[model samples]
Target: MSTHPLIGWAVVHPWPAAGIAAATLAVLGAALWVTVRTARAIAWPPGPVLVAGTGALVCTGFGADTSWRFARDGLGMTDTTERAVLFAAGEIALFACAVMARANKTATSTDDAAGTTGVPGILVWAITGALVVPCYATSGIVGGTIRAFFGPVCAALLWHLAMGLEIRVARPEALSTGLPAVVGRELRERLLSRFGLANRDRTAEQITRDRAVDRAVHLAAVLELHPDGALSGYRRRRLAAAVARSGAGTNGEQRHRLLQQLAARRTSGQLATVPLASPWAGTPVPDEAYPRTPLGVTGAQLRTMDPLAAVRLVRAAHPEDSPAEVAALCTGYGVPVSETQVRIALRAGNQVAAAPAAPRPVLASEPEPVLGAGLRLDVESTALVHPEVQSRVPVLAAAGTRTRQVHARVPADDQTEPQHTAVPDAAHPVPAVPEYAVPHNEDIPESDRDVPDPDPLIEQARTEYGTAVPSYRALKTRYGIGQARAQRIRDALGGTT
Candidate 1:
């Protein structure tokens, strides 16, 4: 049996063989370090590492074996030492190419960082490995060795060039000359189908119609929830783009028509309408539902009023009004009271019968007919005036004239004749009536107040529970409060638990 060229060389040149082995181990360690570092830098998976490592090993082993075999066969050179030297050189060149590729990839900009290379490590190695036998067979020792060294370098460059060309050619859209109309249409349909926007079984006309209907429905929903005025220009453009991408019209005429239809349906009472103050702020209220009325209160003032208080005030003014009508009345007053809140107030009112009607106070006759028209006091005013008015009324009275007597007819059981009290008017001022004398529903329990202060309860909860408070249910149980109040307390506590 003939001794292997490497084994025979090792026997004669033991020191050189040892140095070569050391260099091989050093190259392997370097390759491993580079692979791991590059993989981490680019966030690559272990698959690329395994693939590159296997490629490096296969290329080195195969190229060296092929070089030895070709030289022994006297295809280019019969010198064993030259064959061995060329084999080692080829192995080193292949590894150098791999390291260079990885280093170049790592040095790329952050925007181009990749988890995988454009040309895979395995294919590059295989091409370079296969080139080894041909280079040595075609040329003598000196020329062959040079070719072997440069073959892997050239292979790496060619691989990158091939990848770039493939990418550019693969994009049909990048071609300067357009494709045939039919081919372009087919490509568009294929792309749409891949993205689930088109169906193979459906005709293009049917697809376009379906997409238009979908866009119409989406626009209708958006308008139904948010008025066109509420949508920003960017948001409107985005929505328009979305609609246009679906093959729908871009002018928003369809959206306007949809809004008209939705408004008509809500006006006809076919669809439930939301309050204009809340989720539907900028939406126009239907004329039939919210008739314009001079309610003397602005939307800003109404919004400031407690929702329950607004409901009660509107209900008192229109006792015969339904919950919807009461809500409409408040809406007319510039308040956005939902029908649901009116309904709740009405239900609570039913449980508690209406309070006894107070006697109408007779206004003292003015000496010279006080300037400005007659003061119009809303029916609920005698019961519950807003604090803003309450404070302002006293200040106005203090600035006006002297005291005037106002007679109020009392019940026969209490007094046969009418009772007299000093009252304030525009021309004649008297000491402001005591706040307690106001005929409000004082008989109602303290707990039944429309709005309660949440601060004290929130503070107490924090003191008791520390940083991590229990759920609202636990708070409700401990505080003996309603679910809403407990929730408010928990929310105020930052919802720790």
Candidate 2:
């Protein structure tokens, strides 16, 4: 009775067979350990792990057998030692390929999929086929050749599965949002580049202070654009607190200084545009010339007058005053005046009187403009009042109250006859009230009654919700109003949802 070919060969070459068996056992043990360890670490799914393991075992067994036969017969190597050596080398090479694939997968885990350049699966298959076909053709063993062809292909697929499992565990954020990886490796690198040194040197308190300062800088910009009523009370307080934490002085002086610094940095090139002949274009003036005191003109008059005219008038009366002083005076008067404006006026060489002109007398029929604290309100046209200022002044507050009263008195179903228009004479002059001002009921037409006032609702919402006001639809549902009315309320409240 003849033994199997494999058993007969092993008996003939005991040492080589033993060495081959030992190497095979060692490689399989190492592979098993690595697979188990990696699976546990990345929480790999059971199905993929089982499939990969099965494929790896099948491929390794087939590959070792084919490598041994190919070395002995196809390569014409009669020596058993050489054949065993070739077989072991082939197994090592396959293991090395799998290890390389694992490393490559780990390395590129954080790289954006869109940015990465990977070896195409077709190209890998093609290369594997190119190498296997020639060896299979030379060996002339159909079953052995088929095993050789599929062995490396299955091993490649196993490597791919391992890599996929690693990515699934390590970079789930990339897949979850259908976006490139952002959370772990890339974010760590960016944060290290930006804050590593500072974090190392600074204490927790110091780091916190730096963050507060950064927040204050951002809030300062918001306050500049939307001060007072434009911001909800909560937002205003939060912004003010942030500014104060950054050491902005009392009454926002430091905040204003920061604004000036920012403005200067933004417009640093503006000085180049000034003519050489201008007084401000030359050397800096003495500090004494730029007094902080009020200018000769009142705040109302300063705001009403042109910037250049105001500058010229101030300059003529106080020739000693510098452009900075004039600007300070205008600013104090609630009229923001830049030094550039004063310089431009001085450069123009316009003639001016030694004193400002006297106020013109107002006719009884003509309404006197009401000057509020830091605001000018024209009775003839309520539109001129700034929305922020309108929120503060009592006169406009009264208008809102009167509007509500008028709405309440007029019955929704009543259809009164249209009254004839009357021209005002000496006895019945035009009333001091604005033509379209809502709260008063005297001359308002019936047609205009339905036009809703959004101010009251806006104020009510602000009082209720602070900065987190509801959407227009929510407001419509809450207030039992139409979409248009709700939209008007939203618009009045600075268009915030």
Candidate 3:
């Protein structure tokens, strides 16, 4: 009697079945290892490959038997050698997949974590996704449902990843705000040369952080980052062009000479204009100085920036711009960068941020001074004190019982001289001064005046006597003045009577 057709198949092909099962177990073990290892979110080298292969398997999983049968029956080739070769190849492929998964797992923990991705990984996942419908129908309506949900989601993930690969960063160290930063100068001007407008509206610090300018300049123009750290997509010329123009070799001597030339050009504003000349010519003109080009940093400068720093620039510039948008903008600006390192850079920067006290509160107080070590009163005295003289005069210590002499600067009326009055201490009793009080000399002639006008005396003392302070005897003998007038003149000249 003939045995049932299905009864002996497993018995007849036990080795093949066992081989398939073993390959499946190997793949599953590798996959589990990769899943656990990649939890750190570091770039896994084989991640995209696994994603592509698995997606293809999912698409073909339901019809895998039928495809195999079609290859066997429709083609009509059932040679034992071919079958063994095909099985061997499949087993080897599964083992290779397992190795790739193990590699990703091993790499993340080691210092040789050479895991990375770029445009190629994105293409593989894309192609695998594109192959879904053409290769196999997914469990009838279930596949349709899953595809409907998975299609856009997968596309979005790929887009995000592609964008991540494009972002670059140029992280400047957090400088101490205690050093009065006068930024917004050439550094800011170089950054914003592409914006094509007088950025006078924004402050220097704000301009330093704008994402729009991150890639517009070259690595050299700002003298901040390494010459190779330009962002990838800014729409301006690279600062390296200056080096190329100078014909510097990688040799130390040539590089040194090139650096000197660049320094000279920078001092003269020649490098600032040279990089700006090509891109800005037709863009927008902030002034005749930058004619037609939006005054902005050159794109070549941004290209040299580290991918992580560019992401920071975009986030700082437009907190709302999506990673994809930032990456695209970087590319458009000629700085081609990835947004992947953005999160890492931002997290690291935030850690550093907690250490530095905020440096932006310098504007709360003006540069003038405050009252110190003396009695403080805000009374507005009726004094015609010159601002220059007001600054020079010292405010005396106000010990209530102590007598202190301050120039009681009484404003001039019709009188020619500024009257000086003796200010007794606030706590001291006033002494009678009937004899001390001199008659007013408002209408007195210069020769007859009691305190001889200070200006004329000062002028005469400076010119003829060649002294700023003169003696009472000099005036009494020189002009034949009496003793009382001479004494009065002496007192006005800061002398005792």
Give the winner by lDDT: 2
| Cα lDDT over the full model 2 | 0.59
Which candidate has the top score in TM-score? Answer: 2
Over 4 Å off in model 1, which ranges? 1-48, 112-497
lDDT of 2 by residue, 274-381 (tens): 656666667676764223324545656756878778777677767888778877766665667788787888894443658978899886785534344333342243
lDDT-wise, the better of 1 and 3 is 1
Poorest 10 consecutive residues by lDDT, candidate 1: 109-118
| Residue range 86-117, candidate 3, lDDT tens digits | 52232233323334433443333223222333
For 1-497, candidate 1 gives per-residue lDDT tens digits of: 99999899999999999999999999999999999999778943344444545544654554465556666674566676777676555556555655655544444413322223334345456657566555667566876776666554444544343333332333424332212334787898899877667767877765665555455556655665676566655556765665556444543655565456546644665445643457456777556433433455445655687878767766766788787787877877667778777878777443346899999999988554332344222222266754422332133656544433332333346555566743424432333334433334333334434644434777889899998857755875687764445555666666622
Off by more than 4 A, model 3: 1-63, 77-95, 100-266, 269-497
Q: Could you tell me how far off, in angstroms, the CA of residue 69 lies in candidate 3 after the best superposition?
A: 4.6
TM-score of each: 0.22, 0.25, 0.17
* Backbone collisions counted per model: 0, 2, 62
> Candidate 2 clashing pairs?
402-439, 403-439
Position 357, candidate 3: lDDT: 65
